[model samples]
Target chain A: MAGSHSLLDLTAHALAEEIEAGEVSAREAAEVANTRIGEVEDEINAFVTTTPGLALERAEAVDARNGGRNLWEGVPLVVKDVLSTRGVRTTCGSRILENFEPLYDASALRNFGDDLIVVGKANCDEFAMGSSTENSAYGPTRNPWDLGRVPGGSSGGSAAAVAAGEGWWALGTDTGGSVRQPAALCGIVGLKPTYGRVSRHGLIAFASSLDVVGPMTRDVRDGALLLQAIAGHDPRDSTSANVEVPDYLTNLEDGVEGLRIGVVPELMGEGIEPGVREVAERVASGLEGAGAEVGEASLPHSGYGLPAYYIIAPAEVSSNLARFDGVRYGLRVSADGVHEMYRKTREEGFGAEAKRRIMLGAYALSSGYYDAYYAQAQKVRTRIIEDFQAAFARYDVLLSPTAPTVAFEIGEKVDDPLAMYANDICAVPANLAGIPAISVPGGLSEGLPVGVQLMSDHFTEPTLLRAARATEQVADFRYQMKP
Target chain B: MISEEQVRHVANLARLGLTDDEIEKIGGQLDAILDSIEKIRELDLADVPPTANPLDLSNVLRPDGPRPELSQEEALFQAPERVEDLFAVPRID
Candidate 1:
């Protein structure tokens, strides 16, 4: 345990290699991660619950196993609370399921196959509804770089944990911009694979059509490794793609020469912060200098992505969340009758944003308004997809700022829902289009990190990861959290 | 702008009991958000087909076969209230 503290500095890949080579024991790596979590948990509030006993038990098993053939053998990971882990309390950052323990593990977690040690469950927005972790019923997760700022959400805790070195890597689900936006703010790498590319068997639904299980890691290579472990088909999930899983690390070093990178002009203009825009410009020039052909590509419907997302996401949310009624599991408030029990249970269980969204979604899907709101949003979503397809016809990949601005003060946008929702504008297009996209540390602006986003056609993660790795090298922006 | 009455109606439809203050607050907030999203109404999308699933997957049928299922004990493990082998809920009318 003496030299274990330094293990926090190594990426998940490096840590796994060290453990496999007998340079470090799996328990030692877990101890290092748990120690780091203990040091930073009070400040960042990254995890809702830590399973040190389970982690140690798994680590010992890893040490006892034959050979380290699994890529994630002995690696420490943190799973976002949104994913189900059998017997572990998965809160989804809500009081409704405060003590609810799942009976089955998510397919993604099971895919790791007893090798990766899960240190804890990362906190997130209530049912993954909000742009800031402030919507989390437990509390907000603070940015590792500046405790006063938020680690963007609804995957805020996962991003903050990886940024603070609490875990080597963390699993996060992105619906809208949950993973990439937070990773951008926390100065790490987050990749949302193409929809259906990753199984969603145990990921609690937000917007079912848009939700994707993604990885948040300290570096691009680590992100690729984690994605490789979790990406594939699952019989339990009907929507899971049957596509063959590729070796993500194989083509990762293939540089971006002759790759046509498109910069969406609409995302670069008005409402984007000047400093963040400058970082994006620098990333474009960096890619150009590295021999990638970077030029402006327009997505005319990009401006409508955020609006369409709000309508579409909330509509699905209302339907998905109806399962939380007091009849089955989770929190139940007693009343004189079943109807009153259902009403009172939800009233006491859900947080403010959750109630707001449920109401909005109900209204959108109501008899007369459905055509005006829900249908219209779906049509706009189609337009957004078509826009991306048109752009991709001319370019191999698309580029943009991950968010409109850097991390903001924790309480700054909490009161204003519109302001909080604006944080996801630059990242939602990819989710809407069902394409793979990544957020890599572009640079720092006003002392906070800015993310340069790279998006590619569906199922082209090899190209996307390769281009992102190239950008990662060129930017060379190291993640450093002040003690 | 959405009225407090409309907000209460929607909350009722969603089966959520809301306080007066919550109804008023959410009403104003929803109005502003809806106004911002109203820009989507400007486009002439008459001929465009709505896309519910971007992947365009169809007939995703799994073979009908017996597979492992959660035992009764495991299924009832997390239930807030359970009666023998079934989940217990408050009585209706």
Candidate 2:
């Protein structure tokens, strides 16, 4: 207990060893995390629900396991509220599901290895609708670095919690840059594996086709470890890839010596902040210095990503979200007729951002407009995929700034939906293309973290991790340095 | 640009009843966003096939068999309105 603060700095892999070796009890780790959360929860509302008591109880369960083969047996994990945890209040950051406690854990979270220290359910944008956590039914999660600034979201709380040492790592879903953007903004490692890389069985659907549950950790190595724990096939999720699960740890430290690394010129173009561009370009130089061939990579249709996503993603959203009616779980407002009840429930339950998206989706998929909007976006999606497939044929991995800019002020782009959507300009292409992409901490720009995003072809996580690990070494940004 | 009536009609179609104030405010924002989304039409997509699934997967069939499913009790645990063993709903008028 005397030197417990330093224990918080250990990665999940290292922390598990400590717990296994009897160096630190699981209970002590939970207590330490709770203490940290208590100290800093005021400035950063990272978690919508904190399970201090449950964490202690779960940690004791892990302690009883007495060091099995699990790598994260006793690690504290911040779960984004969108991923259903059995019996825990899983809000998806929407008031509609404010009191909704799931009866089961997400397939990705099913293998808890006895049990994990459930730090809390991290806050996010309502139904994962917005780019910032400001749209959370619960108030916004402020950036720990500067309380006035935003932690790029809808995974803002998860990123903030990990950065603030509230949780060792977190689970964030990336529909269109939710996980990676927040991770980059919070100066952590975020990985969005290929579309079907991770199971989406229990992840509350925002955009079924695009939603991918990903790992958000303090460093590249930990990100690899976290992804290993959750990445696998689930029969329940029809789209879940039945591919061979590789040992992410094996080729991780293997340098990107002879790998072809491409810096996407389009992502680093005009609208992107100059400071962010400098940092991203420096990452390419750093990787080049580390023995990798670095050059410009062009994804010709990349600029169409935002428009395509707004159409495609929202179309999926309207259909997937139709299940949240008052008839079942979550909020229900009583009315004379069943139709009136459904309408009123959604109107009252959803936040403004959610409503806007549902409207956009409904409008796009409407009778006559579906062909022009939805169908056109789908064709654009094919074009985007073709663009990436061509680039990947020549390059082993592609790099870009994770976000166009560093963490901006909280209220900066809230009113401007277009400006908010622009934050993911660089990230949307990866989702659209169905490829694996990562946001690794690439030092700081304007005194805040800038992320060097590495993307690779489908199911090539090993190669992706190799490039990320190499970048991690070159960046040499202190992961333990907290806000 | 979308008219307010269209916005209302879409909202109704989506099963969401919005107030006049919300409809007016959200309508203005939706117009701007749609304008940006309209830019997707600039590309010539006549010959290109649309990608409904990113992986281009279709009709993944499993052999006919009994599959594991949530028990009735488990499924209805979170139901807002339940009577006896069934999910309760008001009669449609």
Candidate 3:
């Protein structure tokens, strides 16, 4: 038990290397992760379900067969409940599908091969809506940093689990700021890859166009290693990019010497907390100190990002969520008529936030309102994309504070949807333009962690990771959580 | 501002049976949200084409051939109610 406890201090990359060298067996790594989960699950509420038997079965298989031939061999990891894991109850923190289990694995999970052990499913916001995991039908996931405060969502469970060392790393789906904002609050590394960089075949959709699979980890290097294992094209998901996947670790150590970095003045404006702004400034200065050219840049349409995202994402949500009626799988309510069955089932199954988004989406897509709301939002989305294109012409990467404030109390923003939506102001633009963005733990403020967001052009995760690595070394904020 | 009637209509269109209290509450919330998002109208984007997708790929048709498919039992595994090989639901008439 003492030996297993020490393994928690190592990064996923170091743990993999140890397992490969036979100093640690696959079963030992799984046991350590299970121990960590047992220690922290109640305080953190990071997982909806834990799969120790499945993890141990897979670990024993790896030990008997290849024995750490692959990069991720014996690495215990958690998957956000939004991803389908065959035979494991995958709930997107919604009562609608509380008992739902998929028959197949997500394409991204399929890419992990035989070596990566699936430790558990992380909790998230119901149907991946809302900025805090308070929307979860299961109780909210508490921030490991402060029990009273929330771990940001809809990927809160994944971030908290990683922060508390429940697993070496975990996967989260980011639509808007779900992944980055949560990672920022928990003081870990989260990357939202370019829209099609990873396949979304078995991910239950929140917003189809904006959703992307990303990795959350303790450090930037582990994030890169996990991305290497999961990213690439899949015929199963037509939206998956067919471009060449680069070896992310190859150029990860390459310092940010001559790279051009842009600091958006707009992001540091009114709503940003002073502490968060100070961290962004420190990251900018750190980059400049590393010999990179830094200057102020502007993306004018970014101010519209939150408003546009709220419309477009809900518009898609209304369409994607229509599949959960009583006719198919998931929860069903019995009524005399079929139509009444759908209505009653949905009324009973969905939570308040899920109903709100669905209704908002329906109103936006209704006949007379389509051109004014949905189509207009799409036009604004185009302008936001073009604005990024213009900025990328002058700079290689842009930096901003991941969220306006640190993690708030669990019930703080739950009642005000607009206030909750504001959390994604700095995050939604990357999703809008289909670019790669990552959140690295910036220095803490008032004893709470702040995240510095780094974004780059499409398919440029290598450069983004490189810049993040350099900034990470300079800031060097130690991440810790008391259970 | 969106009236409770409009919210009720939207709930009907979306096939959700929201209570009167929920309708009154959601109506006020939607009004505030829409009022803020209404700022999108100020932009003069007459000529810009809407981008439904960032990637411009078209015609993503898969090969038409025999392939592995989920078995009937596996497909019906998660059904809330099932009879034989079919998902059971309420009577239409």
Candidate 4:
């Protein structure tokens, strides 16, 4: 494990305090964190690449420039592999780009570099596809809580690193619950900022419209702090929204009293595990105890989110991933002819799930089927967005269980495609509608963590953070898990 | 009839090379997938304008301004193999 006094040992907020006080140098903390990863990372497979030497150098520079102007300095963190990091091997958890190194730092990573040390790139689901890190071409990232189970995925390794105290906090991409679901499973806090609230310039495209980069941390305050640093407009990313960036940490003390919190009736009522339902009830009671007006809210279109996402995501996948053609980038295979070369390259480069998505997507957006599948899915996407907007009109944020269940055994759903897709049933709507959502640890179920998700309309992260802080203060669960 | 030839065309478009046996396997899978997609053809929308932005951000335009450029070394570093200021890859021609 990482040293007890490493940067990973102190919370981002606490580490800043120590750094400002000159109690520890940034380089010393980076070295301690590096030593810890050397001990436990092999067993957990949480990192794809570790750059301790570069991390220490960066730490030294941050220490030298310690004008104490930046709110956070001397904090170490991990960058999700999905975001491009200059000079680092950013594989996106696929063999196709296993050797690919980014030429430029993603704007978000650049911002992170200003105050935090990038310890390494965390492992993830291959192309961010599967619910479990089992989909990674390198290997599955074992849950820190239970080595036998999954850490929930795409951003599984990011969540695992924070859960295991590998880093103070980490950046993770949430496309269809990649960040929130894993954070839920690992008993941490993860936020999926409003679709365009955080720039996507550096992150690899999964479902471009749905993908968001956000913070994964041990506490809600750390999550809010990290969000403040990375949430803003970037000219490089066309999808990035021009919105006011709020001081998330400052406004977090605002209590949820008199705030309208909606409990999604469908999520609480059925198909949810008894344990999850119990936690949801507890969360509502907790909100009510905090002086928030809690009531049931219905979103009927939520039922169709998964089906629509499956169709829409792949259709976009078919087009977005087309750029991976061997000629421009990624693995290229030699064949009898040019056409055969292209054919062989993709077939061999992509994993089974990737292939499945590409084919499904191509068929959905094909000439004859476009109107029926892609077109209809778009309309459904519109309705889902409308449903959330109508609900936000009635409530400050919508509350539900992030996932239907807690972390399941690794390899349990690897072979079942439909069951794997169903995992994102509740989380997909927030993505489709371009809104902010966060998953905070609610309680434990069968020795695993259950998550309570808070979702709000676009650019409502301030309100969401306010609600999250209140929950953190009053939730019956403890932050530290029993070993 | 969507033949193996048509399958090869699409596969080539997607940059996947399939062996003879794999081609046959994927061809069958594509046929089934395509048959299912044929259901979309039944929808008749005479007047619905094709939509892109569901959230209605119609005037989403960025101010045309200069941005920093990636150094040549950084840009070239992303290539799997580069030589003499050019990305090195097997010649398609």
The fraction of reference interface contacts (C-alpha pairs within 8 A across chains A and B) present in each candidate is: 0.86, 0.88, 0.78, 0.23
lDDT winner: 3
Kindly report which residue pairs in candidate 2 clash with one another. Answer: none
Q: What is the TM-score of each candidate against the true structure?
A: 0.98, 0.98, 0.98, 0.91
lDDT of each residue in A53-86, candidate 2, tens digit only: 9999998888887835576767888999999898
Q: For all the predictions, what are the DockQ values?
A: 0.85, 0.84, 0.80, 0.31
The runs of at least 3 residues in candidate 3 whose Cα sits more than 4 Å from the true structure, single-residue gaps closed, are: A1-5, A114-116
lDDT for A72 in candidate 4 is 64
Residue A279 lDDT in candidate 2: 85
TM-score for chain B in model 1: 0.94
Off by over 4 Å in 1: A1-5
Off by over 4 Å in 2: A1-5
Q: Write the per-residue lDDT of candidate 3 for residues A13-78, one digit (tens) a residue.
A: 999888888888889989988988888898999999999989999899887775336777679889
lDDT at residue A68 of model 3 (Cα atoms)? 32
Candidate 2's docking class is high
Model 2 chain B scores worst on lDDT over the 10 consecutive residues at B55-64
What's the distance in Å from true for residue B33, model 4? 9.4
Where does candidate 4 chain A have its weakest 10-residue lDDT segment? A1-10
Deviation in Å, model 2, residue A444 alpha carbon: 1.2
Lowest lDDT 10-residue stretch of candidate 1 chain A = A1-10
Q: Which whole-number lDDT from 0 to 100 does residue A30 have in model 4?
A: 85
Model 3 chain A: ten consecutive residues of lowest lDDT: A65-74
Arranged by lDDT, best first: 3, 2, 1, 4
